[model samples]
Target chain A: MSAAVLVTAVSDNPLEDNPLEQEKVSLLALVGELDYTNAERLQHDLQEAIGPEVCNLVIDLTDLSFCDSTGIQVFLTIRKITQDRGGSIALTNLQPRLEKLFHLTGLAPAFGIQPTVIDALKVFRARQSSS
Target chain B: MTGDHGQQWPIDEDLTALRERLFQHAAQAGMRGERLDDLLLAVNEAVINVLEHGGGDGTLSISQDDTYLTVDVTDAAGHLDVRHIPRKRPTGTVRGFGLWLMSQLCDEFTIQRIAGRSRVRLRMLLHRSPTGAASPDSVSGDPGPDESWARSEVRSSPANGAGAHVDITHSGGTAPSPQQS
Candidate 1:
């Protein structure tokens, strides 16, 4: 059977009343495999997750066991979208294999990668305070 | 050690199973860690190409010798233009990196057309100890610029005169350094 990729929107936190938080960040987690068979689905899900009101995003890839060129493309597309909207996206908990891929393709510095979701959120928080 | 053995499987949507099988063989051959992951990823990309661009159905055959592990993915359809395989796509482009990635990961990659069938062959050198005791001069290591295995083309005479011919073409020369990308 063809391997399927699972995408889940874990949480969307607006932090409306908090003085320290300026933007709503949504967390999405990808699991299983990502390849040509499910690349389009991932693109759609990412777009749906990053609506107008929800800009800052964190994608948790700790559970993603497999990813291919198509998966990389989805990440690139989302990065473009986030940049165009004056928002940012960070990735957390990348498997070593996935990390190798980004390194090989010369994209390691393009994505904001963190060791944990909280660290990723800190990145956004830092950016907000600096701006 | 077993005089070179091979196994074949029909192409299907079960990429996970295919990857698992390839991993099993690589592990059996004493490949581990990053090297094993590279082998699996290269083969996975090639097989996916066969299923998507070639006919929906194809076959994957894997064989190994003492020095090299090889995989051949064949499809019934032919006439694939292997000359212009791109080494890299424009930055931020999504769909064109499969072939390039496969080339980067394998020691040698070739495409051949025989009797209306197209086969993509990928070869990776087996790992050896740092001491180079396994094969001495045959110690498999990172590909270098002067390596002749970078690229070549071969043509064989038709078999049986039934319009069956083999035209083999190598992929591009050594991949650019990762920094070039």
Candidate 2:
């Protein structure tokens, strides 16, 4: 009935005003369920948010109550896009059930999950520094 | 065991109502927490599979017993092959996760074609609380390959496509009566 998923994005480093580096890191907090019914809409939203300049993505699932295989497919598609641009994606605040789904599908390693958004951002920073 | 304890819902172009009905029925059945979430997700995937691929219409029959809650989704499009569903998780990222997910979430998964309609049956073990109400248990994780299909049964006859009359009982689990005309 209502929107199945709500995507809220925040620029992690807004003060770094370089055009090429501006908004490269985005923190998307997902609220509500993501399933086949609204997977396409969420994919479109994520694609729009992940522009050419934007690279690393941190998805916060603190309020995400449910996710199906279709929902997982959306993240996989975004992961490929980010990886192709020499960037990575991290997932934060996964509920236990969602975490179990990721583990069951053997996608935890591919997504680089973290306990919190801050920890995920730190990992991205570490990766950038090392590279 | 009788008509008083079970319900059926039609799966057509609109699934919003079907989902709501499921949530209400499942919650009233005493299912809570992630276990409820798991059942909803699994059944949602099954219904969507029917709409997207199985001639766009079907029926959902839900019944529960002392130890298991069962949902049987049957569609007129008899194209699904239980053998074709991926047993192991697919290595690719984008597709091929829906059927696998259905199998993984439920305690027993089975598919059989009857009278030219394909039916996918999903059964989840009901954990009872101290007061005898069904509730979620602490068991959460991947059951691995061996455990996922612990009580699955797939019967297909060569002459009738995927239709084979196989006994649909597992340790006292009752067979859902055929609803086809």
Candidate 3:
């Protein structure tokens, strides 16, 4: 079968009482394959998920089987948008192959990558407290 | 040289069918896991390049041997300049990563302009034979003799300049022949 990209969203902190912890973090779980054919869809889904109100974002890629340069492009686009809106983005559960791709392209550092969703959330939380 | 393992199909607008076909062929040829994914991604990038810039459509060919899996994507537009493929685009750039990623994923990547067509060849090493001995089933089909034709109009390598030397040849105004570079 041809490759496909499937995305689902999980919200952990939708609303917080404290303004410091108020940053809404939406975790997007991606599966299947991400390539030129379906990267645009992923980008659209991501754009739709994060709005002017929703800020902090974490992409869970535990089940992602494949990703190409187009996929990486989507990540860059999202990062730019999130930064422009005064938000943060992180990625968690990257497979070894995907990690290698980021490393080869020298993007590992540019992206906020953690081992798990919790760790990614922690990163956002740490930034909130530090700010 | 064309082998029995080689197959070609027309490039479609979305390239979904092409990706599926290439995936199945690579899997049947013994590629699995990340390697298969890499091959698919590389071929997809090449095909996308053709569809987006080279022309609206092109042709894709898949072939394999015991040690290497090869794919060739050809387009009518000869606008691609291989030497200009950037290894990394400035951060936040959306385009220009397809060719770079293909070069990184495949063991060898070469682009040639022949008879007003842009042909991109990508080869991935299936497995390294420790003894340096060819597998008995490696040469399953007759690839025919290699014959020289018109010289390539332009040829370019990745920034790293890795892999074997590629030879570009066309047969009596027919389909282009495979070269081991």
Best by lDDT: 2
lDDT (Cα, tens digit) per residue for candidate 2, span B79-126? 874543555566764455677667666655777666687888876666
lDDT against true structure, model 2: 0.70
Worst 10 residues of 1 chain B by lDDT: B155-164
- lDDT over C-alpha atoms for residue B98 of model 1: 70
User: Which regions of candidate 2 fall more than 4 Å away from where they truly are?
Assistant: A1-4, A12-23, B1-3, B13-17, B127-151, B154-181
Clashing pairs in 1: A1-B14, A2-B13
TM-scores for every predicted model: 0.76, 0.76, 0.76
How high is each candidate's interface RMSD, in Å? 7.5, 5.3, 3.9
Q: By DockQ, highest first, what's the ranking?
A: 1, 3, 2
TM-score of chain B of 2: 0.67
CAPRI class of candidate 1? acceptable
Tell me the alpha-carbon RMSD of every candidate: 9.4, 9.9, 6.8
**Looking at model 2 chain B, which ten-residue stretch has the lowest summed lDDT?**
B155-164
Q: Which pairs, if any, clash in model 3? A: B164-B181, B165-B181
Q: What would the per-residue lDDT of candidate 2 be over residues A1-131, giving only the tens digit for each residue?
A: 32658888765442344332443577788898777778889999888877776678889999997777778989999999998988889998999878877876779999999998778877776777787
Task: Rate residue A71 of model 3 by lDDT.
Answer: 81
TM-score of 1: 0.76
Query: Which candidate leads the pack in DockQ?
Result: 1
Q: Is candidate 1 or candidate 2 better by DockQ?
A: 1
